[model samples]
Target: MASTRTTRLDRKQVIDTALRLLNEVGLEGLTLRAIAAELNVKAPALYWHFKDKQALLDEMATEMMRRMGWPSEDQSADWREVITAAMQGLRAHLLRYRDGARVYSGTHFTDTSYAGPMETFLARLTTQGFTPAAAVRGWHTAYSYTIGYLIEEQAMTGRTFDLTARAERLADHPLAAQAGEEMFGDYDAGFDRGLRAVVEGIGATLRAPGAPGKGRGEARA
Candidate 1:
């Protein structure tokens, strides 16, 4: 991998180098030592900015979110559009690098960059009258689904599911054989449909009888 710039290294520069190298070496190959070598500094230099490799990864994930450009108040359209667009952006960002989903899975960012976008997402829902608890659940639903789905998507990138081949061996099973179309459908469409379902379910909850029911039929209608 290419070594970093000769200028004084900072947190952002280090992470930029790490992500560049990530595209080349992948998640498994990303390490503090490797990053230091790229920056042409001793490994200990990284500790000044990041406590450890996980901390660095958190920043990397944060930077990726920043670049996705979180929604603004004016950017708000319908609630469903808000939720689906956020989910889709996250999924696309995670797919930008190899194993990015796995890399971002457990990392937490303690900085403003992550906070701003997250706040933007939750605020969009709250302004529509979603209760705090409901807003959180909606965020979790979409975020968790994006992360989990992308993890599998990244894993299955070069491999084939080929349920058809397995079905041939079990030819007696009619259901398995009949599922060929279902098994090999458009992945992007399937993911969008799943995200839409989650958003729709959250909307349903708001619309249930005796609920605050804000942004339900009103915005959707």
Candidate 2:
């Protein structure tokens, strides 16, 4: 049983405090003790609200998802448009904090409210001629792409690595310099172009007869 003092602390309050501390400390430094200190509570008190650090992380990710406006209600938009918008929103949200992608990665959501919205989103895709499996897979691919991109993006921008020194080393290599420019320049445009390519590939799978959820006869004899 939680003690009177522990019970008095709100779960939301603890999670919010952890998020604020996350920006200050990054993931490595975001311990339960740190959060408790931020809230002016004992470590045990937080245990009443969160079983462990991972549990707290799960809730933080859930809150991030909620803020990102997941399951956005763009039912009338094309499936590709829906996917692009979702990935874009996710990238933007994750970039808002230090190590945001790392924090969000691999954490289970404590909230089940997202399930209903996900079901509706999937249903909309099926209604628009996608096989349920294909719809899910396509979205997974896009989600993976977004997360992976942000991980690299955050690493590049969040760190104090000397880009100028590296550029000097590669100055003799014209192609490498140009590649660096393409990679480090205009993140927004690069993400959109990559997302477009991914969406296009997913669209191609829809017409492939052997693709998951497609009819057997749909393939060319």
Candidate 3:
């Protein structure tokens, strides 16, 4: 039931406009009105496509997932490599936009097309003898780690990483002063280390006795 003016704008156009607004003003400031203004259309024009801001947000999240494209077919790679690539791909994709991870984390997509990437990756774990429950938990843990890391990474974008600044104010705080360098040095390396731990921990569970979907006595006693 779109008017002539509204009919001119397709759903994809509206979503693109909204994403541009999101980059300019961020998630907190991204309003339907703002998107409308960017599109040079009335807010009601957008209503023809999106019922509300949440709908718009959901599309945006789905669009980002789509934009990531399907995962590559690395036939020789093990489950760990595949899982690592998927997690790191998500983190990299989320970092592309301002407040990308936050926007992605907060919304639920109506698009089920994301299942292509998701199911394939989960199948990899399941093939390695992981129960559905264990696979889901492991996937969630890796995803949560990526989201949390990206949130912290995005939050630190504009801040200076000077340990000396901390040294001036927190000189009396011995532990903070001692660990400031460790805290700020090489976020990329820190993230990789954490990612390895997550992958390794998931693998450990697969090898642990009493883990679901394993042969009896398959692992250590």
lDDT of 3 by residue, 1-221 (tens): 54335448899998887777777788899999888877778889889888998899899998888888557764334667777888888888888888998888878987798887778777777766677778788888899999989988888877888888887788888887877766567778878889999988888775345434433334422
Q: How many clashes in each structure? A: 0, 0, 0
> lDDT per prediction?
0.77, 0.79, 0.79
Per-residue accuracy of model 1 over 1-221 as CA lDDT, tens digit each? 75654566778889899989998888889999998988788888889899988888889887776777555654346667788887888888778888889888887765676766677777777766677778888788788988988887787777777776767876998887766545455678878877888888888775234443245456443
- Candidate 1 minimal-lDDT segment of 10 residues: 207-216
Point to the candidate with the largest lDDT: 3
- Residue 76 of model 2 has an lDDT of 59
lDDT of candidate 1? 0.77
**Stretches of model 1 off by over 4 angstroms after superposition:** 1-7, 170-172, 176-185, 206-221
What are the TM-scores, per candidate, against the unseen true structure?
0.81, 0.83, 0.85
Which parts of model 2 are misplaced by more than 4 Å?
1-7, 160-167, 171-173, 207-221
Clashing pairs in 1: none
RMSD of each: 3.5, 5.8, 4.9
Please rank every candidate by lDDT, starting with the best. Answer: 3, 2, 1
Give the Å error, residue 28, model 3.
Answer: 1.8
